[model samples]
Target: MTQRICGQVVRVEGPAFRVRGTDGTEWHGVVRGRLKKGKRTATAPVCIGDEVEVTPLSEGQAVIERVLPRRTCLVRRTPLGGRRTHGKAPPVQVLAANVDVVVIVVPAPAVRSTVIDRFLQVASSGGVQPVLCVNKMDLVPEPAARQHVAEVVTPYIRSGIPVVLTSAATRQGVDELAALLRGNLVAFIGPSGAGKTSLLNALCPGLDLRTREVDARGRGRHTTTTSAIYDIGGALVVDTPGLREVAFALDEKDAGDPLLLFEDIAGLAARSRFQDCSHVHEPGCAVKAAVACGELDEARYREYLRLRRALERSPSD
Candidate 1:
């Protein structure tokens, strides 16, 4: 007779999963066919940090029977040309489930506001708190360079998001970062070369994960190829592979207004004279006025428009 037990999926590698059972046993498992074929919009039915039921077969192998409902999930739009249903839009990719926070890490001297905005939207939409982690501060040793980085993140700070500047090599701001992550399940995400793994090493000290240097073009070489959960200090940290693009999946209801994460813009929009103001050529648009008068960060406003247009073009299937 097979014994059924509950476990949390700690790592996902293609069709294989590593689940840590409630009894402290580790099981290598695969999802049941029925669960895999369910009518879900997610590319994969299982992800790291998911609670699941498994039936132990023999040795350390098990079959994942069911996935418990997720309290929160981090997701992104599947890349174009992926598997489609009747030529419909691509499904979303579930990155992690039941996460308390999504940390968007970016390297100093190369901060990209567009990427940060996209990640913020997805985290907010998924009901997870978002924190900005500026890593590799050692790369920006000059005072002017450091100030430049500060200016880049000022808008996010003004929007009430927590921003931490860290350098894995020098241990700068590691204590503060650790404080925010203590006792919480946090997922670190960012483009390649942002030092997610390095920060993890700095925080846990001795779990020396792999590290790769950025290319000559200043692009990060992929170091972490898979997503996995680690128990670091008092925090459960999920370290994921670097992402090149962060397109978000949106529900039909959310398609009309994609500014849910942009509080500054949303607040201004509420005061617009026209109820349906697009903030582009609409007369008396509060958002546009704010941008023109320097009341709002112009770069952030431009990125918001870019994201809105991208969402408008997204296919809802």
Candidate 2:
């Protein structure tokens, strides 16, 4: 009888995978040809955090026979030639599987609301909880400047997303972030120089993940070239390569109302007089009314409209 065991994919590199078996052994495995040839929607059939059944062939070697169903997955639309696809809908690329929380790390004093909203949509659409992690808080030493950064993320906090202010240099909020991630599979995703690796090091001492400083232009240099999962104090954490842009993985059916992710906008929409109010230019539009009365954050409303417009535009358009 052949020895078959269950394992979770910890890292993927081209055609090779590192799977950690239930018996506490790490096996270098590759997917079976039949499994690779099967119909799939994602750009890759295997991703980090995927559970698979493996047949051990020899020491430290195995063949991945099947992939178990994912409880949750984080995905984004594949870019065309390094840009958003215009004509045909882009295929989805699965970033990680079985993710419980996605930590969107951003540097202080450089918070981009639009980018944060895009990441929120991706997490919400993928059935994963989103947490905003504002890293490098120590850079803003002055109280006024630090307050400004806090104000920038207040909209997200109001929308029920947990926001953690962390400074790897000062070890601030690292414990809070770790508590939030305890006992869950979390993925750290953000643009380069956001200190994802540094935070991981703080959480699990002596891990010593390589990190680089921001470039002269203030952009992060990519240090993590591939996605890999680490076992940290009973929690499984995945650190992924920095992303320059994030586009929603949506087909016609999956591209329904984007407002579902924007709780603040949705709440206002519920009060609109018209049951099908477009909110762009409609009579008794609660969303616009709130914006006019200064009850709603203008920036948040603008981002919501931008996302809605993007979704409304057809692929061919």
Give one digit per residue, the lDDT tens place, for model 2 in 161-231.
99999988899999999899989999999878888999999889999999888899999999898789988
Clashes of 1: 0
Clashing pairs in 2: none
**Candidate 1: residue 178 Cα off by (Å):** 0.6
Query: Model 2 scores what on Cα lDDT?
Result: 0.86
Candidate 1 local lDDT, 126-242, one digit each (tens):
889999999999999999999999988988898889999999999999999999999999999988888999999999999989999989998989989788999998999998888
Residue 254 in candidate 1, Cα distance off native in Å:
1.2
C-alpha-based local distance difference test score of model 1: 0.88
Candidate 1's C-alpha runs over 4 A off are 1-3, 81-86, 288-303, 313-317
